[model samples]
Target: MSERTPFRWHIAVFLAPAVVIYTLVMIIPLFATLDLSLYSATETGTKFVGLENFRTLFGDAHWAEQFWNAFWNNVWFFLINMAVQNPVGIALAALLSLPRLRFAALYRSAIFVPTILSFVIVGFVWKLILSPIWGIAPSMLAAIGLRHLFEPWLGQETTALTTVALISVWQFIGIPMMLIYAALLSIPEEVIEAAEVDGITGMAQFWKIKLPLILPSIGIISILTFVGNFNAFDLIYVAQGALAGPDFSTDILGTFMYRTFFGFQLQLGDPNMGATIASVMFFIILIGVCLYLFGIQRRLRRYQF
Candidate 1:
């Protein structure tokens, strides 16, 4: 019998490229951003300001208000996805996984089609579709005799965030749908047959038997949704522009950070402040991930079957 090597060259060789790429792309840039947050631009040059920037972000009168607004908006964004997107995905997954369902593959494929499209495309397509003048939304509402409800949703502060959230949900719900579908499919036929024989059919079977087994998957989806929503920017940026306007009603941390970094119409770009915001966002995401790992994932039991 041959003894296993204490160290494997092949493993190291295979891991080297990914490790190098990650260092360059993710780790280095993250540390660089953190480093940038410690310094401030001066009239002549730049100088280290330590935690002064952070204090300004969290305590300064003007900065604090905007920061709080963006933070609360982000929370609202995440909550909306949890409320509508996850449940809808779970329901769609269940429907797709049903036995003897006709055109199941076609349905699944069609449902997932939106998920693979670029956020830019989705943003433009939805923006145009919802436009009041050149678009079909107002006309569609008129056709349904609900033209009173056909006001430009994206142009209104009260409805803009919710409309954007629903659009985001529609675009990405397929991810959770596919994930939950895979999890549902992993259940053994024998276990399902046993449940059926015991008279646990329909909703009872789903709630009692299937739901328990898929708790881990659901937990994963919840955390993933949370993290993704918190970090999301592209669709919002494309749809609403960097200002995320209608009186900044839809502004979240990502857009807030971008506006700070790149300068909007009247505001001058502030890299130090932008970096601080990015660092804060990083911490927020880290806290959420840590909570999922320690608080949520540990409690979610996976069934052997």
Candidate 2:
């Protein structure tokens, strides 16, 4: 072997494919979309409108109201997932991570089955289950003398958004559960033994020791939940359609963008408006991620051991 160090072309070679693909697929498209938002389609094709498209999105009463409504709805959707999914996932993960838990693998597989399913499949399956016509929700409720409680949850203004949010939570809970479980498993056995020796057993050990150590993992899951929930589209689209129907009660930014871009029933498509909506969503996600990383994550001191 030569004494001189060889040139490190391997690193560049390995990264080239991923870098090229990302630039072409993600970066180029993102910039293109941003550029597209600046131009509005007219009779003679697209016209440069600068910030006029954005102003129309936020200033026009008709568009502004819908945009704000969708933004708020997206926030609520994200909040519900954060509240429901993470806790349930953590609880299930904690339970399964226990040393003596029976059939742990089977339970994990069963719980994770939903995550393996496509969004289209999950949405349609839930839609059928919750459908007023052929859905089993009413009958299932009736079986327990709670039939009176059933009322097309997916079709009502009061419950439509929340019901859809919960459906999303159910379908994706496996991700956090798997992540937390992995974190829990990574905890050193010696540390647990030490905790046991100090009379910290069972729930005490989990809450006082394991939880603190795994907090970084929880933070990661929380941020992921925020990002995914805010950007969600396929589930709601498949279940409620692009209009987010029943008086647009379930309308979120994703569906709103779809409706703006494609038009539905009466409304004509507006590409400039659609791009503006998309730009807004991108910023919202960016802000959320920044907050999580700089605000929440900074305070969560991760332990090496």
Candidate 3:
């Protein structure tokens, strides 16, 4: 019998650093937060409360109102990104990927530049531009004779969340565009040639061939968008404050968690409650990812090509 080769311990050795770092930064913190959520600080000391915090979040009137409002707001935020940003990104990617497109590199770079900008800067700049008193948006609208359509979008409750969501979309559209663009470019030239020979060309080729192949990438982008939307705090906080106002109309879980953890305005900090919120967020993201993996991803048949 031939001698069996020694197990490749080198693979484990090579992966050890990454595994250690991820454990230290991600896994440890996650479990710690979960642990923290089970305790509450009292006058004496921290005491285990089990699921009391969760009950308070769901059953307490004020807490439940804020939580549901933020939850629905977050869902709307993700939906807006999914509806507007991804389709726009895909369309832009398709146009850029066309044969003999002029100045393609410049167009791509120009469109992607906003993605690298700091959230603070983007929020501040957009705030200035949308300021009702002296913003350029009003001026530009007036110049086009459509000034009547211009409202104080960021200031009004009805429009604040949508305005901020669109701003986020503007800042991040490049991500899905680049991801989808790469997916498009990775399609085998042989596949294109074969399709053309079968009289599948142009839009038909993209719809029947390229689009199917890129469904996996689109799915990835959707999950990412979902997670990012739920985790969103910076822009909302920067633009709308920790209360996520126009009367908390823009409040999402991230901002809610931040205010709870850090103590905003007159409210005192409650680390345990904050951790509970964080745990809820963790579970929400986990459930979304699991559904995508087990339900959606399995059904998406990836072609060998």
Candidate 4:
């Protein structure tokens, strides 16, 4: 018999199953959606309409207004998370990772518990806590002599989006905390000791040494937060429903797409329009990721040590 080739095909064979699954599930669906966006359904079944769906999504007065509103609302939601969540997460992580801190593990575990929860559970739990019928939030505010602060925050147009953003921040803070904590832990003890010996202790050491070394990690966390915030959906959908009620004050791209594609209370679904919306969302996410990777990430200098 001829000698067998030395190189084995085992690695490719093992990887083939995963690659096939991903291609079929993700890649195929994405392309199919794109293809469907080019055609509109009618009594005669789907007919090729080229760019008509996109034109209507962007140019028609009624559809365009709702599309823009949802798009802007999504942007606002993302901005709030970036403004509130990352700083708070970084602060908590820094404090918890501090040397000689007591009960650090317990605090970490408690804070991270929310992140492990399902979006539906977290949404309903917060909804109940904030509901006027339950009066839990008002009761707490009254206890602090701030009863005037109480209102149906989630039902009000002014506060609904902010309330939802804060809820998301609360749920996901643990992610950044854990990531940053791990990065902090990776710093060598010898380096920290050297900083202490150089008359740099306490906050000074952290600002000068620790902060510089962890900048790369911070950059990474910021990009991750950016992507996650942009892609957010489930919590808002669960808490506010697909309509994102109170006059659509809480509507984001995801809910908007659902309403447009699947129809709501009285409206009819439009698959082509839905596909257009999905395509827009895909581009938005792609742009944000590219900006982070090429613009922000390239400028960050990761230390070799």
* lDDT (Cα, tens digit) per residue for candidate 4, span 1-305: 49978667898899999999999999999988888888999998999999899898889999899989888888898888888988899889899999899999999999999999999999999999999999999999999999998989899999999999999999999988998899899999999999988889988987899888888888888778777876677998999999897789999988898888999888998888889888888888889889878887777764636
Worst 10 residues of 2 by lDDT: 296-305
lDDT of each: 0.92, 0.91, 0.94, 0.88
Q: Best candidate per lDDT, number?
A: 3
User: How do these models rank on lDDT, best leading?
Assistant: 3, 1, 2, 4
RMSD of 4: 2.0
* Segments of candidate 1 deviating more than 4 angstroms: 1-11, 302-305
| Model 1, span 145-246: residue lDDT tens | 888888788999999998999999999999999999999999999999999999999999999999889888999999999889889899889999888978
Evaluated at residue 243, the lDDT of candidate 2 is 82
Which segments of model 2 are wrong by more than 4 Å? Answer: 1-13, 302-304
Tens-place lDDT per residue, model 2, 1-305, is: 66887889999999999999999999998988888899998889998989888999999999999999988998899999999999999999999999988899999999999999999999889888988999498898999999998888888999999999999999999999999999999999999999999999988888999999999999999989888878888888999988888788899999999999988889898877888889888888899999988988888864645
What lDDT tens digits, residue by residue, belong to model 3 across residues 138-227? Answer: 889989999899999999999999999999999999999999999999999999999999999999999999999999999999999999
TM-score of 4: 0.93
Better of 2 and 4 by lDDT: 2
Clashing pairs in 3: none
Cα-based lDDT at residue 208, candidate 1: 98
Clashing residue pairs in candidate 4 are none
Give each model's clash number. Answer: 0, 0, 0, 0
Regarding lDDT, does 1 or 3 come out ahead?
A: 3
